[model samples]
Target chain A: MSDFMEQFAELRDQKRFQDIVDAIPYARLMGVELGEDESGELLFSLPFHERNVGNTVLPALHGGLIGGFLENAAMIHLIWNRESLDTPKIVDFSLDYLRSGRPKTLYASCEITKQGKRVAHVLIEAWQEDRSKPVAVARAHFLLATTS
Target chain B: MIATPVNPKVFEPMGQLFVSLPHCATLGFQYLGADGRKPVLKVDWREDLVGNPATGVVHGGIITSLVDTTSAVAVTAHLERFETIATLDLRIDYLKAATPGKAIYCRAECYRLASQVAFTRAVCYHDNPDDPIAHGVATFMRESSPLPMLQEPKA
Candidate 1:
């Protein structure tokens, strides 16, 4: 069987990828860019702007907004893999805030922890400026549309 | 048993089952559409709720919560009585920045309900409901246990 990364590359070239990206609301807000690395991993990035901040007084981004952004990133990765704009139902999600997302662009990457026929588990990490230092981490479980 | 608050002036019965929940308690959630098979909840904008200061844009989280809560309200309309609900999953697509300083509203409906789950669809707009600024679909799980305080005392 072809690996997920290889399939991802083939799907990106098919031009079906943009539709998946455009369907996400947070993607429009943050202006996301979806790309693939040499290893076939999906790369999602957004430029951090002043508007993303929760308290302009503190100049810190809201945790909820951060959650929304990361959730969209992970969801898009799943859609890209499946090659469909229809999304799986999110069963549950939990996020741990490591640090404040500040005045810089943000990048996120995700890995499928458990890919079940009914449920898919994913782990996502987000950071700004430096990849080595992660700002937040999330674990999400999605219930597939076809699953009973 | 502790009594649930009931004020006659506010609690006008919408039907045999539903009460028109107080909009004042909901904060700018007034603008209800005409009574019909599926009633709509409206939200008119006020300056205080903006999420970003630079453009006076309402925060995405506020919109998300509005969708979640209003969806639950629609579900409550169908219920025999109050039941607790927990958000299962919610997804929203931001179409474009809403026009600043203009009153925006939301139309939320609960379209699907299973034994354990309720599914909802909602659109947020300004002035015109036809033109939507954000669209959302979410699933909410009903809570099984009643609060201890609300439990009836054994005779």
Candidate 2:
């Protein structure tokens, strides 16, 4: 393992979590932000940006961007919930677009439905305004990185 | 209303329309013509799009976006009109991590286009079509009619 990764494993949960998020280049390009809800669950948000728009007619956010946000949320959720320092590899991803994502700030949350020795399943939901009315939802299966 | 048969000529301009989107432009997506009725798109590998810094592999999210956008283009090609369409669902299976520093190509065909829904299947590859990096299936909700009012006035 690299010295940086070893040091990451030694850091506290909060710093380690931040490092993981920071390490993903795509997440930074999309300007994805991470925070926590009142219940201590991780919350992900993508601030409104013109570069996120896919359809100029409806001015809708790109479907892929929404999917990426949910996937990133799941990844962060997995890292935050687990103790491993290795990054998870995505096995498969499925997303259902519940509604057209407007060009506005979007929020997301993830739930780990199942965690096994070698794999993990996550459900993620992304919304714009109302939490109940999600713009998109997704399920992802990830192969956990083996600890040394 | 009887469904109109879309003219193949409509694809060129429609593909241009897709690449005009800000997000698509930001990701350097290009409309790489087509194969038959299917529309093909390409995104060259770049440092900013890497997911695994250690391996320099493109993120799965970028692949998802590429497939989703290519599928949408296929739907437009099937319709032969710039009707508003929203992705209803998209499922992508990553067969392997994308080869670093190689441009990725995606092609999709709208196999079924009903009044309200369009179904598409897509594949992403790096040098050979036979060996795909990812396979995707998606469904899109098609608006019954064009909503011209929602469109930005052409500058």
Candidate 3:
């Protein structure tokens, strides 16, 4: 990890992290809260429920929601790194579905693949329980405001 | 819901009309709720068409499709006609996983819409309404086509 990334991990570990997501009303609506492990790793999980119902035949998850989860994961990871949201606006993002997220709670982790001065690139994966396996994967290109 | 067939001239932008799914044309989408310019849609997560990997968890592609489609829905809600809709950009944030046991419910809202593009926000929640498993924001470009086309899938 770079020195700046290392510093971010340190600050987040101390639990002084605060951002608009902490105060956003929808944060509670979406059941998304920020938590870090002792080793400074970030984890996001979503449990199964009734409201997610699609149909009696498939009973599958929505692709839009999966994309939402990935985007949030990437954004939160950026915030965790102490990057300003205004510095980056999503240029584009894409997701590939590998398999269905099983009936267990979904877990995700994101890595800042490349944090350039004008743009930041991120990669994220989501799966159920097992970190080694992934249900969906996504990449994000965030354009820094300073560049334009 | 209008059941007008899409014109081939406009549909040509998306290459071919792959799936003639009734859901997009006949049943159509109902605008349920919204906050300001943001509009929410209550869509049924069907198992047969959407898929069931295990017992209850729905496929993540459905959610991605919903977000992409709804961005257009927001545009349609404002424009009231099916033109070409292309996703300029999209980002999803996964919160809690999803409730695999039941259907996935979502409320997608469009927050900002301009001449070049429209901005949308959304959340997918199941079991508990207070918590959402996923959330998203996307930008869409209105084209003179049949439906919205997202960038080719990225795995």
Candidate 4:
């Protein structure tokens, strides 16, 4: 297995999911926190920061960061329950901005629509306050390939 | 939301202002002026932006941000007057991983503008325009709060 997978396997076995996320700088930089539902399904939350503002007029969240949140959430969902070392490669990401996200903390949840042998499609929704009124909805396709 | 740009000539200042916005500046996007008729933008590689730690490739989200922002700039450049253009949707295809230390650049064009929508396509590349790390197409809804003079007269 690759060195990354080995390290991931090691840390994943010994700690909670947040600990593993804390070990990754990318997640830390985004300031995302992980939580679970009543059923123990993972959910991602992005804390509000001043630098996250995109337009100064209505003061909305950057669309890109919202995309980043969704993308990362899907990836985290994929790896949370797996022992395989294969890191899922993002193929494509498509998102619709349903409404302008207010300057508030954002949350995302991923549902894997289809998980094939070598490819997976995940659907993600992000909202700021009300989950029913999602600010953005996205679907991503990932290539699941083993690294030597 | 953004104040309306009076004319296409303001594209330069508008592009700069777009990047100077809190989020864009935080990500280190530099407005490179226009390449012919299209608007160009740049983002330097940074450590915290690295997505795949194993390969040290920049995050795909960085490219998405670049494309989406650049596409909005393209509309600002293409329009006679600009207002709060909302990004209705954006689709990005990850073609290749960006090398860790390379500053990526983007060029985008607003291909079509209708009564209610603006269409744009963009490509992000490290060195050559033909060689892209990612390509994206997006649409912006023209939510124009037109002045009384600019509004359509009674038909």
lDDT of 3 by residue, B29-140 (tens): 3445444333454445444322222223443444565566555555555553335554555666556445544555566656665787777777767654468876777777
Docking class of 1: incorrect
Q: Which lDDT tens digits does candidate 1 get at residues B1-155?
A: 52221322211232211212221222345536323323455545555454333446554544654555455555545554445554555666666667766665666666776889888787778767678887777776665334310222245
Q: Order the candidates by lDDT, highest first — what do you get?
A: 2, 4, 1, 3
Give the Å shift of residue B154 in candidate 2: 13
Interface DockQ of each model: 0.05, 0.65, 0.08, 0.56
lDDT of each: 0.57, 0.83, 0.54, 0.81
Question: RMSD in angstroms, all models?
Answer: 13.2, 3.8, 14.5, 5.0
Model 2 regions more than 4 Å off: A1-12, A16-19, A145-148, B1-5, B144-155
Which 10 consecutive residues of model 2 chain B have the lowest summed lDDT?
B144-153
TM-score of each: 0.47, 0.90, 0.47, 0.90
- True-contact fraction per candidate equals 0.03, 0.76, 0.15, 0.63
Model 1 chain A is weakest, by summed lDDT over 10 consecutive residues, at A1-10
**Counted clashes in each candidate structure:** 2, 0, 55, 0
- Write one digit per residue (lDDT tens) for candidate 2, span A1-148: 3443455455435454455566778888888877778998888888899999987766788999888888878877886787776778898999999888887899999999999989999999999899999998999999986545
